[model samples]
Target chain A: MKEETIINFTHHQTAHCENGVVSNLMKHNGFSVSEPMVFGIGSGLLFCYIPFLKVNHAPVITYRAMPGHIFKKFAKRTGIKMKREKFSNPKEAQSKLDENLERNNPVGLQVGVYNLLYFPDEYRFHFNAHNMVVYGKQDGRYLISDPVMEEVTSLSEKELEKVRFAKGAFAPKGHMYYPISFPEKLELEKAIVSGIKDTCKTMLAPIPIVGVKGIKTIANLIRKWPKKKGIKTANHYLGQVVRMQEEIGTGGGGFRYIYAAFLQESGKLIGNEKLIELAKEMTEIGDLWRDFAVEASRIYKNRSRNDAGQSENYNQVANQLDHIADLEKVFFKKLKKAI
Target chain B: MKKEEVPQDKSNLESANFRELCYAIDENGEYTTANSTGWEPKTVALNNAIDEINDRIEDAKKRVLEGKTSPIEYHMELHKMDVGILASYVGLWQWRVKRHFKPSVFKKLKMNTLQKYAEVFEISVDELKTIK
Candidate 1:
């Protein structure tokens, strides 16, 4: 029997793929940072319900920032350096990855979420920007640490290449990244303050596409959907909203809970009790988001629940979201003063 | 959002094929974690996506039977794609993919092109040529 050939890599199942990949990469470089800390330093918390933009013919609603932005922000905040490369040709990309693996380098890659065969069919979509680490090759299959998976998995070279070069909607173009260096020690004081301010700016942005206003916009959109698209079609939209929020990439309550964990960790790192209290408030806000998902899902389940009851459910969701928005608003404001 | 309403069915949570742990608040507003088997709210999302693909497949099958479109069309819809998306995956242009959607063009397509589409759908070319 052929023996297994996996580079020394620790697999950690994290709430978000980008956070997990970045954290794992840092750990590979001897920097011990938690997933939540990576997420926070990257400033992964934000909201935008852009009706103008569409994915798979539906309006786009992103709970987190754009792909690769978080990793860039994290590196900017912490003094870590990484080498990221994208290949135009799949053959060259394959050779580069093989060369890296031959040197025992565990490389991170960008892949489409849909073509990953190991993923449940129900969970697959046309999303083309999922992140994972490729650590080894054995018998023409690649060992992978997909942060969203419960365990490390392996895929054939053909399967990996298909996902890596998946077309349409944020094509990865064979992108790969790994840290080149890490500072002797991480002084998170400046990084924490900067991350908090970054989040605050996103939350407070007056543009209609994002932040508190975006929540209100989505609520209003959901309220009108039942009337606009009819109950059945509207239910599909609602299902997709929560799916984007929670289903894709360990999303539970739109990463609000993850952000809370970051705040708690950051609080401890800075030794500020008030930040920890703020973390509690953020957790409560995360619950409010989950509450919206539950009520919205209930509405989706009840197709014939009548317009009045349906309207009431949507109103409750909108009201809860608004409440959550207010809480985050205050939370960021207080966070600014806290630090 | 009443914390009480959050599910706590230990059996279901444990028996679920794939469960995820999400950091959440407990009933006491404490920072307690929850083990979600992705059973409740996520099921609604999962079922909806499945239904959408099934509906598309049904429509594509109907079109293929009526000779209005080719199996390539059905296969594309089965994979939940449009002309532009398929074009990108197959390294073809949008106009060409639109042309290939016709039964006449798809029937005359060379083995190389058919192989590309087959690899995308992860099926044999014979399967791609014939309706299942």
Candidate 2:
């Protein structure tokens, strides 16, 4: 007679969602892995500015690895047994999740950001790849451990289903996963080397819309905002960038700081002083990202009353992004050789 | 974000019973910690998005009251989705969704289509048929 049950899931708040969800799930499953360590070993550091991919009429610029990649890579690196499932039928998915929870297992879920009632109305959007965990159900509520929030929250079963099957880019499709077990030995050094190499490769990729090239492309487009797009249009675009970098649950610096934290932990674990140095540089670069957001925000402070937007202001912010791109190029190359 | 820079006046943050925790570079330039109070810019970013959503809702509600559209359109607006997004969830094409916006077509929508939208919105088919 399997029925409703609540797992004693201890929630530890962290910088990013996927990293936090997987980290907390690991902890509940008897593995001791820090959020940053999970982030690092999974090769979560990345910069892709795919301009053609539009969300809300702006280019998709991201500062981390693609969704679900970190968890997949982390499980593989640590030799942990993990199970993931997606359902064509929401009812089946909910039943499977209920069965898992009935056994006291906490399940990680990917959901859209727009419909979670606990989310600040201002922060809700059509973003479809946010991650959280469901530990149990009681009465008519699903207990959720969303890492970005300060505390655990509850969602109605119906509300949970709506978000689970939310449509758009990177749709969750009722996706859920749980860790089964882990090997005694972890391949830390091997994972570190591969992570550094992949990050460098993405930065040096030849395509103009990815890696460092993509940053350059975005910089050029941003610089032309005032002249080509006009003040009102420029304000809208700049606000969009700020929203992507600062708001979209990045926690900070478009998630560069989290990757930087990962680098720090990996450095100490592997005793690579050079990695420590690279981590410091990454932190500095992360500051530059914050600076870019601040300056861009200054350019269009009040969208309704903004009258001072200039080509120079747009160009100046563009130069800073280009500068950041160049700095990342240097950091990634050094990271590639630091190992 | 710095401790001094946290915004304490965002009403929605408290209303939703949600608080944002951020990773900020400390004095030693390390990113190993987190701050859950609030950041000014992050709060502002959210405030902007909420404003956008509310604006859409207001526009959508106006459209529906005038009989230019149906409750499906208003619900989608409240959810901050376009026809493309709503279509994908309902497994319908964008044109069908566009047609669904019209009251005449929406009234004749099959039970299956109505059920799909009801599931998407977390509302009943009866409620979905009438805009509040």
Candidate 3:
């Protein structure tokens, strides 16, 4: 009976609410746990738990990459051509600038030169590259100005002068252009990190219910008891479920509704035998969810470390998450029989 | 056709010469070789000519260091003047030391030293090949 309580507690509504607590824990640990957690929870439920519940729903996955052809109309509307060039040394890649400058020269006659430095490479793509200076020839001598000076104009002459006079001043500036402003870089970095955080938050959305499989398992065990004790034990399990639902609702109202629906639908089935089986199946599903959440949390930690520039441990953590997902699929097959 | 016309033409020439002299003085701190190479008068004048050319080269070098004149400018200026020719001449004077020297050697030296300068001038290595 005690073991059933533990299992039911682990597999009930309150388990999902633990995500908020974990998020606060992440904050306390000084790591931005927002994105990976969301992605983990949302993806975990979609890929792991939804099939267990026999819910016919499809999950949408979004990632950062080049836009699809549907965006071609928007591209024409914006009149912006996104083309990129690669150079070993950004400063040494004179031909690229010369070619671009020549193409833009006719337009420059009216609007000034727009010799923007572009980072077309995936690794070097950054917003800061918009502030770098572009150098070219006017008449028969050298000329220099901000590459994206037309777009962002806060770059001061003094800053340009300082860059012009720096050591190895003749060395070709690299293709990875960064804005002259540190504040801009910081802001851009934060936005990028925030996007990743949001994704994590979405992934972890189903965790509260998944976290409390113990209560569900206990409910099943109580239903299996002698008729005299069964009512009392079942009432205790009901009380636990209600409490778990309340906790989950307090943290995030979404899981509360989900749990309530699960209870309402399962309650309509006749006989204690069917109820016991449903509880048992839910308990198993809850355990898988808990395992998935733990693994997802671990993966998030590793991904956060990777974002912090630690690549060595990232692969190992990713592999572990893959293994956990595979395990969930197996459990999902078993839970589907109950449905 | 008159005496006045002759004096006017002579004055025009003199003014042009004076302007050239002033430019040289401002640029090289000497006036003797302002109009043309002051090499025919004597060894002192010939030495002064060399000194003035060297002064111009030194100024160009300083500008390169200061990121003012780019490598393309330096290479182009080298083509416009007789500095490389003079350096080759001096190298020939020490034939024993310069016997193994070749045009390729000079090219390699130029590329290695002036590559950074060319980058500053926004001239690619491929473009630098077309300069000569």
Candidate 4:
């Protein structure tokens, strides 16, 4: 293997190990455990097999939003009927919005109420609901532009029309319109877990063999042995030497370059001792990513209760994977410099 | 009771003298019926009596334009006779025009200057087309 590639793999392995520790710590706390769920599952399995995947800094929960159905379910479960009250008139809605604004709350916590009115030339079946997404404290309200889908793609307008016009409690078309088909809940959860595992594995690929004849020759000699037997023995021998080199390089010019870049981005500088402490703290990134993946997968699984599209599920997983990749890049760059 | 009757007698005599004075002014004609406070006829004096009525009308108009008056109150004052006359003043036309064209922009426009500008420019009726 090339020296840089071997070094990169070593860093990746170390990052994964650190992530595992952080995951355990997080589990010990009130937070959820990092199970082999979502894209993290495959990544976790790969890390278990390889000795080099490593990272720093446990992932922190940054953003979350309530899905439409989830919010509806929550309201139902709580028996909180969200009745549409007469807000005097359209003008009064603005005043109520203003009144709510004086109470200091996070922008995300604000409730947005909207009146869905259809305009001319729009499809009756695909009518866009005018929505208001209230945000900011100065009584500022922003209109949310996204629309909620009320029916499935398979159901025709005629079928929907019958539902809309249907009367009585037993009306099938109006009361319960299925938007998407869902798999068995357990099966859906398993699939989501498997997707997470695959993502993590892809992020930590095998170290490339080029440029360093010495390491490559050794790796080649090891390859001659049984695959499983050789990998374990080779990693053990290589890991020790790599660890020592990393320690020595910590005080060198490479460390200064990493620190300077980090300081510039963060707008905070630390002494060498503090920098070392931060570096140690960051070693938990892999574990945090694992936890994030597991939680995200669980959320997706819960969402599967209501029929959701394959593309929707895929998009959710893709977003988590993107976040994981971003974390990986930061960890790798730092580790590469440290080595 | 007798002492109370003496004060009553004095007031009655005073009222009698007042009635005689009214009669001396030819109160026997239709003017007699018109002279009583409640029975008074509507006259030109009634209109002229309210000297500051124009000012009150202007005030009410300004308040309505400023959004200080509720919709119900605005319509009520707008329909009032004296206030309606103030609506004829050049200032009211300017106020209405400024409110029509650019509400926020005209809100800052001085009342006096706006009235003068409307008169000098001969912009009648405060119509949207006339403002341009």
Candidate 5:
């Protein structure tokens, strides 16, 4: 029998997977980083509507930056060195993971969500951008630290490999990453400012398919979906939007709440009252998002609704989204000036 | 959203035995993390998506029973994958994947091709050959 190896890794449940994994890894490395800090410093927020791309038969709407972007940016801004490796061969990937465990290193991995047996059944889908950490190997089962989960779990060798190499859009392809080096002291203030600036620029970008413009574009689509796609398809599209906003792990309200928390934390740290005030405004915007979701879901829930009723509900939801877009536009502009 | 206002609506997450962590402002006007049982709107959207997938699975099963398509279609839906995604996993072209949907074409497929599909679904070649 092979010897067992387990690193002393602390599991911290977090709102989103990527940020949680990054923060947990930092804690393991003797750096106490909060999830919001990781999210903010990594500039993890975004709103992109990719009408050309399809996921689960609906146009893709993402609430966060692309997978691995957070860790990549966090490492770059803080002068931390990260080692990311992808393997074409499953055998080599498993061996490399085992090697890391033997060396007492907990490795972060990007895996598909569908085959995560430990995940809640309702949450398992064909999403391929989920992140987790493997901290040890014991009796042919790997110890998993999925930050979104409440507790640590274990997966057998086959189960682990299947998700590690799960195939599809944004397929993990046996991707593994971990921090290799850290500076003697991280420049937190500089990193925070840079991250905030990057987010402000992205959120205020002039592109129609992204940023604040993207939110309005979605609002426009929501208004037309009922007439153009019929009630069945339109409701499905609306449900898709809500799922992307809330179900796919945004800490509720499509990451707005998370960003507000980030601003609040950074405001206290940087001694900026303006940012603290703006965080309250952001929270209100988040409440508006939740209201939009609730209103949209009402349309899809009442399947036997008359055409007139359905269209009115759609209009209301679309109006709510437009309001959110406007609020976010003004909020980002104010945040930009505050920073 | 305020800390006390965080929704614990007792949705699908209750069955999953977990609560989602959410960010909220406390009474003191400070940011805090709170655990939510679930939210109603999220639960509705999640159930809708799952129901849609189940509906597709049922349709695929009907086609398989009528012998209008191969077991591959049923298994594909059961595994929560589309033809394009399944094609990528099996290293087959999209046209070939659609062609294999026909019972006759799937029957003529060789062991190697069958092995590829079976590997993807994590089932044996024999299991891939027949509907359960």
Candidate 6:
């Protein structure tokens, strides 16, 4: 006999998946942490261009930190005790998940995006780092709260198992996590300060492949791509950049808007006027990134518009990125001072 | 973007009955969340990616029909997998997977070998042996 259980879990849609799951789970555990706060405290924003790591036959250009990093960092900074487990055997994984549900425990699960049947058709791809919460089991189906979705959904036992053990890069391996305990009081002000400091240091890091320097490196490549790799491959690479920035549940502008919102809330909470001022500046920067995406997409979509015009468009977008990089360099320096 | 300026452009996602959340500055000059049907630039990029995948699948189907490559290649493309990913799923080396792409090599694959691939693709052994 199957024991049916459903824990009362609320679903709140957010701009990104991991942050959404983290925020929602915290709420269920009686801590009302907003999505942007979770993102900010976790220091989730980042820019890295790894040339050797190929995803979909193009170089990996990531706009944020790696999968699971946000939740891990958020828990650590807030002094939340979380229990995480991974299983090598599917049967064991299934039984463990069932046991948790029987005890009315809601758990966050790392899964592959490809096999998630509820995803929109266009968003279904072989990406392996998606996260969701499983709060209940009823009639042999698992109730799911995918942070990217507008409402809660469900999946059959076989379907959930497939994604949990999905193959390829960053495979889930049946990974599940949930909060076991929390500090009597969260040190929000200190966490926010440290988070801001860490982010500032990362963005200003002295490295070619990460932070502000990485943004410049991509801008340089955008200018060279048309001539170096020919129009077709160059356009494909440009599409990859846009997809990473806009798609993948980023809430747009590669999380700049979310970070700005975080700063605004943090400023109000900690009574820091400087952070409020910088939040406005960050919003403008996010707008600049959206503008860059527009121009980049135009170039890729209209490659046959004209050769001279195409190269000119590429340069224009590259210039836009360079300008954003410069702005970010200044912004992070200011943010570091403000905090 | 301003809350009012948050784009609600008609996009492919609209047909999917989903709205993505966006953070923007509202009328009060405060940050707030809004639901976006889609943005044009993102839609174009997303469509381009989907088109590319569809094109690859079509090309793979043509090759399989001509017996130029094995059914494995077509099925892999259909599943949005490349050599590296497919190899990982099947617990085989990438080079080995590539070698099996030849029609001749695929024809003589052992039952267990074929079973491994069938399980990965979620198809039957006989189904894996032929092009759809």
- All candidates in order of lDDT, best leading: 6, 5, 1, 2, 3, 4
Give the range of the ten consecutive residues with the poorest summed lDDT in model 2 chain A. A300-309
Q: Write the per-residue lDDT of candidate 5 for residues A214-244, one digit (tens) a residue.
A: 9999989988988888888788889889988
Would you list the clashing residue pairs of candidate 1? Answer: none
Q: Given candidate 6, what's the lDDT at residue B38?
A: 92
lDDT of 1 at B97: 86
Residue A267 of model 2: what lDDT? 84
Report the number of the highest-lDDT candidate: 6
lDDT of 4 at A199: 28
DockQ of 1: 0.42
Poorest 10 consecutive residues by lDDT, candidate 6 chain B = B45-54
Candidate 3 regions exceeding 4 Å error are A1-45, A48-268, A272-275, A291-336, B1-132
Q: List the residue pairs that clash in candidate 6.
A: none
> Which portions of model 6 miss their true places by more than 4 Å?
A303-306
- When sorted by TM-score, best at the front, the candidate numbers are 6, 5, 1, 2, 3, 4
- Candidates in order have lDDT scores of 0.80, 0.79, 0.28, 0.26, 0.89, 0.89
Q: Candidates 2 and 3: which is better by DockQ? A: 2
- Residues A1-339, candidate 4: write the lDDT tens digits: 111100000000011111222222223223332311111222222211122321110111101111132223322322223322223243444434334333321111111111122211111111111121222221122221111111101222232222222221111121111111222222223332233333233333454321122223333333332233333232232222222112111111112222222322222221233324333333244233333334333333322233334334434534544454455545534433431
Off by over 4 Å in 1: A1-5, A248-251, A303-308, B1-16, B25-34, B102-115, B124-126
lDDT of 2 by residue, A142-240 (tens): 889998877888998789998998888889999999888777766677876776676678778889877888889889999877778777667767777
- Mind listing the fnat for each candidate? 0.40, 0.50, 0.00, 0.00, 0.73, 0.72
Can you give the DockQ of every candidate in the order shown? 0.42, 0.47, 0.01, 0.00, 0.74, 0.74
DockQ of 5: 0.74
Regions of candidate 4 where Cα sits further than 4 Å from its true position = A1-291, A294-306, B1-132
Question: Tens digit of lDDT per residue, candidate 3, span A305-338?
Answer: 2232223223333343344444434444433343
